[model samples]
Target: MTSRALLRFSSCESLNFPSTMQHAAVISCVFISSLLHTGQFALIETKETVWAAVGDQASLSCRLTEDKDVLQITWQKVLPNGEKNLATYTKKFGSRVSAGLEEKMDFQYESLQSCSMVIRKVMEEDEGCYRCLFNTYPNGALIGWTCLKLYVLPTELHGPFITISRSNSPPGSVVTCSATGRPVPMVTLTVLHQNLSFSHYNTSRVSNTNGTVTSTTTALLSALSSTQVECSVLVQTAAFRELLVTVPGLTDSSDGLDEDFESDDKDERWLVTVAMGLLVVFLCGAFGVLSMLWFKKKHQNR
Candidate 1:
């Protein structure tokens, strides 16, 4: 109904009430009528922030507080430069996604009063704020905003490559271990064998363009009594990788001597094989010469 007609009706109703009650009754009627006319009760509810890991699906939803005859709901992504419409849902048209975002974004749930959008295989570029616009008759549009944050956690830990360099000063070996992961993984060194002594040398970090960090740590080993050292690469308490390395000069001297003796034995066997081969060749030649001589004597006797 028209505002003027409603006000007239409120005045007529208020005439039956007492002075103090009439004012309150009229005010209530006018407020209720105004709310009905403006459709201001159509508010949307949504989460403030949604977080998801990269390559995972991120779902964003919006629901109207009060039921309304909504025509359509448009989902938009808020960018630093401007906002871009990603998808839309309507009863008549169903769901439609933007051209480039068709593979990445789509409507998960479609309704006039409530809707949700899903981003498949979420990437770093997909991290941003989004808004859902509810289009209603007479009310224009109601908007609700939600922001997305993408996190990249190390999934499969690769390696803790260890390299050793012998140092003359103080008579120790310098051990270096490195690993690459997202969010800067931590590298640590420990001596696994007993009687092994080591001290911290230094650590360095490098950032890559692909959003990964390489961490390297160096340590000085004091004693040669221990042979085994370990390197641990960790992103957090949840994810970790470990590698074991053998110190070159710290192994038993007997093992080296045995290896050398084995090598010498192999060389002796090879020399024997060559010598036997030569003896076979000489014997074959002698047999051929003796056969030729016997055949010549038989021919001369014939």
Candidate 2:
């Protein structure tokens, strides 16, 4: 009975040994695979989009999440034609720029693990996407893409000039808001009075020689009982300026026109008064000189 019990226990141990070996083999393979991938691959951290004003400096950078055996780092500018190599950094050679790109851009920070470059004077031609490539061993090249956007901001924004005219047939006020800025600013018109309603139409844009744009938007005002309106001007996402103008009543259109004419009349009258006073001063000086000359001649004759 003891021999039979021992034999049964031995068979049970033999049956479980193969199962244990299979489990150990699987765990070992998983561990080795994780190690290989962790050593071979790297994560690149970078900004997706960077913005800079024209004639300003722009910085582009990238970093590695894990330590990589980076053989070389290449910075490429994406163009409409093709990808052009701008600069490169290596562990052995330090940093080097391409033949023609030395003055345009330079390496801000350089290392095997992280790198950055700055464009000294950004221009419209320099606006495009850039790529940072990590040439790593065994994993080939790990690439990170970033784009640079260039803009020409207006130095001085022109007036959001508001003008009102009478529409004879519709019997309402025709309001126009205009502004000038770089990159074509957006113009918005709002009527402040609750009883007033307006419909916008005919937005026109004109490009200037100095790389600026003039935008004019016209709206038809109906039931205009209010005396005020708002105008907003925006360039890209930035709020450039805002203006408030007086809206003459629909029935009071003639009043607004008359007021403008009256203002012009006042200006003309002031100019005429200045001219008349200057002429009188000249005539009085001439008369006094002639009388003095006549008296001197009589004295000399005596």
Candidate 3:
């Protein structure tokens, strides 16, 4: 072991042994794990993935091992294209957190031993891999990595989008409800009245040109005396949105109206056919009389 390591290990024996012993034990484990790196020694405990919902807060914490004099702590984010420097904090310079992220992060314990950050109102862009680094005096640097996944909640999930139209052929109604969200929401349909039943249904999901997803559900109702139905959407982020569709006629049914229009067209065609037959008979009688008159005048001349 180097002199710094020997001094650090011996100092724990002189100080509060219980608390200092914990640091020594963690430091010894890190040193053994880094036989290739020699003097660089630091370890932190945290999860590899953090799941959060849009418009909600998330936290990433890191606790260093046997770190007394921490020079700087840095947080970085890795995206598909490249890496972005998120924030940085130094004991002497205070904090140099990013512009928009200043109000979103909490830097209460900005030191070398413990570096923690809070993400406020997580958004879709926040989903990515994050790296936390601690630069200490003789130990060099310690790094810990984590990833974030942010889910979007359903939006504008209300109003005429939820509708019920009366069934013309059958003695029931067809109910359709559509909701939009990211991470594709899971939609469920339920009739309000106790005795109502769902005979059959169809559901489809479409990916918009934008980043959002739209889900539409159609439910066939039989013996449905219910005045309303409910559509509940659940997102991956544990956030949910719900809307109720009053069975009150949202669409009109025009079944058999086209047959009435066809009947009227047939009656008009029959009237035109009868009028043409009468005109043809009148023209034939007039031509026969004129021929008779001409023949009589020729015989008189002879």
Candidate 4:
């Protein structure tokens, strides 16, 4: 072959080699790009709903599908008015200037591709929708949204009550016990006297129409001495909630010792009455014997 023709054929072969390889490479690139775009779109479309209680920690998470193109990911809070931004990622947006954002609010960025917003000491106002935005090259963008709900619960139960009063009898005692709590409570009262068994009393009442039931008890003790008396109030609420309160007993000084003194005086009076009656009988018998002896002597002299 001629040298010029050989050179031209070699050039043609070189051009064809590249042309054939270009189509395959372009097809492969298109397939990969399609897969990556689809995955990114899925990540943006599917978001999880997060819930947390007040005064607890919460996290908002977002991941990128195309790691190489991920430039920055941001998290922002959208206000209820829809026209203002409540808070924004401060690391990427300069220092945070939001009126409500405080130093305790934590914002964490991962490898410049993922974002996790950690909120400490969450409050009711913190409950709202949060947006996740991803910045990428080649006009690619991904956005995810999540909703957070915060709930506040009550901390503790209410109270148990006790009251005491005297009965109609002079120096007698009466006691009343009660307790109040959420969902109502069962109450029991126990009265204790020294050298005596415990006396128990119980009663219940439903004060509210919301099925809240309250219980009460009343008790009385007689002949009470200057002794320590104990009045106990036991309360039980729904779900085994329990509370106990004890009241010191009332001491009756006059009634307790006076009864014993009166009994002793009556026994002494009875003994004195019997002794006088026996003396009268003996005197009468002596007078009768003397009269009979005088009559017998008069008859003998006649």
> What is the per-residue lDDT of model 1 for residues 54-92, given as tens digits with 9 covering 90 to 100?
789999999999877788889998988988988988888
Name model 3 segments beyond 4 Å from true. 1-42, 155-183, 186-204, 207-234, 239-302
Ranked candidates (TM-score, high to low): 2, 1, 3, 4
When summed lDDT is taken over every stretch of 10 residues in candidate 3, the lowest stretch is: 248-257
C-alpha lDDT of all candidate models, in order: 0.81, 0.81, 0.71, 0.59
For residue 94, what is the lDDT in candidate 1? 86
CA lDDT of 119 in candidate 4?
A: 81
lDDT per residue for candidate 4 within 97-207, as digits (tens), equals: 356666546666655566677788888877888877776676555767787876543233344566656655543555566655443455554434446533434476657
Error of 1 at 135 (Å): 1.1
By TM-score, how accurate is candidate 2?
0.60
| Model 3 Cα lDDT, one tens digit per residue, 1-302 | 55655655565455555776767775774465456334343366667888887789988877776645678888888877866777888867887888887887766564567777788888887778888878777766677778888765555333226776677676567888787766676778888787665667788999887767788888877642336678887776566777886564322233334567888899999999998998888888888888899999999999
lDDT assessment of candidate 3: 0.71
Model 2: runs farther than 4 Å from truth? Answer: 1-42, 181-184, 190-198, 207-213, 223-228, 235-239, 246-302
RMSDs, each prediction?
15.7, 16.1, 14.6, 22.2
Residue 108: error of model 2 in Å? Answer: 3.0
Consecutive 10-residue window with the lowest summed lDDT within model 2:
1-10
lDDT at 259 for candidate 3? Answer: 60
Candidate with the greatest TM-score versus the true structure: 2
On TM-score, the stronger of 1 and 4 is 1
